[model samples]
Target: MTSDSAALPGERADFLQTLDTHRGFLRYTVRDLTDEQAARRTTVSELCLGGLIKHVSGVEARWMRFAVGGAPAMEAAEPGGAVAWEERFRMTEGETLAGLLEAYERVAAETDALVVSLPDLDRVQALPVAPWFEPGATWSVRRVLLHVIAETAQHAGHADIIRESLDGAKTMG
Candidate 1:
């Protein structure tokens, strides 16, 4: 286990800290992006910085609600849910970098608020319909939070590589 996985003062604090770390990674991936650069696909893959931002935000919103046993916010229902890996990375018409960034910020704020209001990370909740996971499996709040962190961190790395290829930018902090 890593230092970040070590026990902390409490579950909520630890979960939030992990989330914040991943969020920082995501933010860094899109740092210094211009509107055109963010939406540009530099690789054979369809991924652009803007599309990645939108994807992560959408995941955050869905998972947060799933973890808390709450109905997902209406905006979370957009994009028809669970696009294929290829489709997810693609930038659609009318999907501007600025628009995606704004949506990300909005969804992130809602997620933060929901997590903050929870009393404990051990609360029982249902898992979202992930392709690899069993249907209707339950998870503790802590597990869901950790999953979100892991998911975001992985995608942030992808975004970093794409961003670098787009303009020769370094991924180092």
Candidate 2:
């Protein structure tokens, strides 16, 4: 659950630490949980714990790709697609919490390696057309990493709430 980005100093370490803190929150929320438990929608939100993790993992992977390459095509498998959006909220058939967790760990490891090895944090990429994004925009890799961290943190909070509603477990307590 550790990130190599923490080994460095300055903004890199700070960013990694922030990301790790939230990742830890999410990891703890899902620990000791079974497939059924993770799949449970404890709150009114359609997002289950496993689904949240999957969504985050996929998003990080895509952004990492964008950082390394350019943005994907409009019809690509990016999350904005109708199918991807629906699948992002829950475990699809044959997907388990453990399996998704393992995949997420792999994605996290790759993302950390990229973050640490990239020579230029300022490398920028133009964002793809999306309703949620501006008509034309670009973001640096560093900004993308920060966005990942922020997203993970937000979902961690949601997971905490869902965990509490499920079995009265509180990650913050």
Candidate 2 per-residue lDDT, tens place, 45-83, comes to: 899999988888887788888888867632356543455
Give the range where candidate 2 is weakest over 10 consecutive residues by summed lDDT.
73-82
- Can you give the TM-score per candidate against the true fold? 0.77, 0.90
**Model 2 stretches astray by more than 4 angstroms:** 1-4, 73-83
Among these predictions, the greatest lDDT belongs to: 2
* lDDT (Cα, tens digit) per residue for candidate 1, span 1-173: 12333433566556667777777777877777777888788888777888888788877877777776533432255555555556456567677777777777777667666666677778876555668768887778777778888888898888889988987776675
Q: C-alpha displacement of 62 in model 1, angstroms? A: 0.5
For all the candidates, what are their Cα RMSDs to the real structure?
A: 5.3, 2.8
By summed lDDT, which 10 consecutive residues of candidate 1 come out lowest?
A: 1-10
Model 1: lDDT of residue 5 = 34
